[model samples]
Target: MANELMIFAVITALLALIFRFTSLIVNSRRNRKKAVAFFHPYTNDGGGGERVLWCAVKAIQEESPDLDCVVYTGDHDASPQSLMDRALDRFGVKLLYQPKVVHLCKRKWIEETTYPHFTMIGQSLGSVYLSWEALCKFTPLYYFDTSGYAFTYPLARVFGCKVICYTHYPTISLDMLSRVRQRSSSYNNDALIAKSVWLSRCKIIYYTLFSWMYGIVGSCAHLAMVNSSWTKAHIEQLWGIPDRIKRVYPPCDTSGLQALPLERSTETPIIISVAQFRPEKAHTLQLEAFSIAMKRLNGGKPKPKLQFVGSCRNKSDEARLQKLKNKAVELNVDGEVEFHKNLMYRDLVRLLGGAVAGIHSMTDEHFGISVVEFMAAGAIPIAHSSAGPKMDIVLDEDGQQTGFLACTIEEYSDAILRIIGMSETERLTMAAAARKRAKRFSEQRFYDDFRAAIRPIMCLPYRNSNDVISNRDTDEERVCTTLYTVCGAAISNLFEAIHKHCVRAVQRGESSSLSWLGLRRAEYGCFVKFSRLLQLNEFLYKVSKCGKIFCWSFST
Candidate 1:
């Protein structure tokens, strides 16, 4: 009887091992070589972040077939295969996207939960689970790019995979912080209470968390990649990271931007502004600068009509435009300045094809993708002399003295007027110089730089002696990882639903005759402050319920 029992136990143990090994084999079968995954919160509109993500994808695929690219974006319905196909063909890079997950930014439940994944936690539980599943299926080397999502580093590192950050720019700009503080004081009435209450929890928490995360991941990562020298300096300054951050300037498809044979007519000198309408982009400042320049040029010489072409991303930006139009009307330059939002790429290229000068006003914009786009079209770029432009756009010897650097409203006005008065020979010379400089940021160069950044990491050995794990992880971990990921996603969705309903309930009751029953204006103030103990209890319940769902599913 004792012998038989021992025999049964040994057989059971052998079966368990067989099952584990089988799972491992299945996962390893799908794992890819030299693969890195890129995560972006939103995928719909192509922006600077998207530009960086796509460039690396193209480079990795071209340089190393062993490398695979996985992109996580917020465009929920986007067909990953189709998106990847389109991007790869256009950019000369082969790539694929992971099944996208929907993430709403303003939705309280999602913002609080999903935001933390990239910030403090290297990876969100859901992201890890999904990523793990992908690894099991493909076994690609997992390299992460933090340029897209603000948070996800902690969860990423915890998974024990190599990560490469294509850091475009720091999240918190000192200028942005000062503006927020100024606005907070003016609107909140009680300065102390306003600063305490309305100073934006997202900015403070997200920036501090991401800053810390960047330091942590940056110090220990397999590799660090940055877009511009300005960004590298910024990262080093902010994080005090001793290690050198590898520079990979985001590629601009300059092949198309080669000098077109369009004749320069001195009759209608066109001034162009190409940028998405955001407060940061400062379209208002562009309008004001143009108005001031036209005034300065009013020696009865017919001034150029200023054309502002780009899409507006926010309602507040649109409203700001209307106010600027009012200013234009007040200044009597309304007809001379045109605001065109949402231009097709081809149309924009055509517009740049005609324009003589390109204008950008965002202070220290990480890397001005549009600025180079303008130069590529043979338009002389007179960009703000800060951030990425200072380092990337101009030659050190001449740029330091002759480069356009506007610090104030008056300075921008002066720069525009000065550009207008330059002789055709001078303008053409500057335009040629700008175009020549823009060539350095071409797609091919970008790919080469990106390959250089990850070559060392990709060369690392896998457990398999002969074969390297260039792209992803082993099979057994993948199976468990996927199981946990699917479960976590379901939970996140459930929590999001609950949070929406609770916030909605509070809002709907606002019109009720019973002031006490609904959230009074005061109770709706801050999540940190509520009047009665029960109200606090109710708020906590909602936060906890939302947090609980997030924690439970994400923790898996």
Candidate 2:
């Protein structure tokens, strides 16, 4: 029965391949324009990622009038005109050429709900499916993933498209592995690890194996552009591909912020935080830190107020904002805390200019564009002690700390107190130093770096209809193509099963332990087959550790 099922799978896969090839041929013949496709599912999110997308598209459009740009987005409700208007109003990025939008409906597969057990691996696989959907809808000469979905690189290569990626952060890192290993008492500690030593070891093994897979996917990209030094280091280390990753600091609109005068009254010092309402941004931490800081400054007349200004991308973000408001009230600082959603660019600049300091609480942030913006606006920055803020932005470059770095709420509170207590001259000096450091990540510099990174890839010979069709004439080529298609489809089907099981589990309000174990076994079986077919012995050896980990998790 198993052999018959295998044969049936192969037959159906071949038929699907034939249909896909025929469609590709037809699309290629009909759509003759050589274009670069930007694969960013949330292009209208009004976040830093969206800014990067629009800026990248604008840079490509400016480089050549002949080269067209296409954006693959999951914002199905928004029209291209609305996106353009939002981009201009929010980021001040004007598009010279209107980008053709390819709306993808299957983006939810990559969401958190689809992968309850193994989020990284599940989301990575889901991204491959989403990329496949985009590729089928509109084939582009160069495929650029601006949303940090490195798993799409191999699929892009299979389709004969040059791959470029602007990675904001690595999907898997040594830090993630370390976190799994560390059984800390903090709220952030892994529950499985905290429960049992055996489970902790199993999770470590799982993370180690997933890191290997993540590296393989990342290495497939032709050019990997990272947004910060921290990101560059992680990508280079994980991908094991040195010299290929370039640091392209994200564009921060500093000119407008810099235009505002640095002199501001500190009678009622205002601390501001500018970041989207994402979980990783640590909005809760920001609120807690602000509350702590307020308590420390009780004796000071007219205590400093905290303002949270950021964009909300979806209903979840709105919910997060409401929760934050409740948290502020719980801390008894609700009256002093102000929430501003989707503030206009000019208004944000005005607030930044008036604020005494900017606070960012997210640890290991990829690159705090908001922190840089704060510095450019002459707002003293108080950011977390790791990642971009510590390593790149708030450095003691000129023998002086440009901004403060804190790790705990007490530390953040102390930093705020220091800023509040500083004299006018001392405050201005630090603010000037921060402003000087921020110039390194200006929009002009980003344009130059981005253009330089993409120019060579854009110059590469594009695979035309004839090239794609002729390349598959050989038997080996055809076999490999078929196998790739079959492997991708198998993986997608496995993910679909897992997704459905997770949905059913959620509806039933129970753990889908049996379904999860079955799916994990099937996934391992598929991985073994794929590795053997591709003759990736080393890769298989590394990935097999995950099977052992799965067994341990199942046993537990």
Estimated TM-score for each candidate? 0.64, 0.81
**Candidate 2, lDDT over the whole model:** 0.78
Q: Write the per-residue lDDT of candidate 1 for residues 1-556, one digit (tens) a residue.
A: 2232244336435544644544453335334355566655445344566666666665666666655566654445556665665455433344533322323222222232355334224343344444444334444356475543323443344333555677777654454445445545422123553466344555455556655655554554556677787877877766565364788788886877675643466577788887766556877777777877776786755578788776543455567667767877887888887877665455666777888778888877788887887777777677787888876774532452223667567887887777677787787777776777778888778877778777777776643312222322545434544554565455445444544544565567632422434445445545213212323233333333232222322232
In each prediction, how many residue pairs overlap at the backbone (N, C-alpha, C within less than 3 A)?
37, 0
| lDDT of each residue in 1-556, candidate 2, tens digit only | 2333354457546645655564553454336457888999887566788888888888888886688888899988767787777778888889985788899999998886677777878888999899888888887778889999988887676555677899998887777667667755333345656678888788788888888888888888888999988998889889987777789999998877888899997878999999989887888887887788787776754589899998887778889899999999899999989999988776887789899899998878889999999999999999999999988899864776789999988888889889999989999999988888889999989999999988877776654544433344655545555555565567556544554554464456443343433445455446445533643333233223222222222121
Best by lDDT: 2
Candidate 2 TM-score versus the reference:
0.81
TM-score of 1: 0.64
Residue 204 accuracy (lDDT) in model 2? 80
> Which ten residues in a row are the worst by lDDT in model 1?
527-536
What's the lDDT for all of these models? 0.58, 0.78
Models, CA RMSD each? 15.3, 12.1
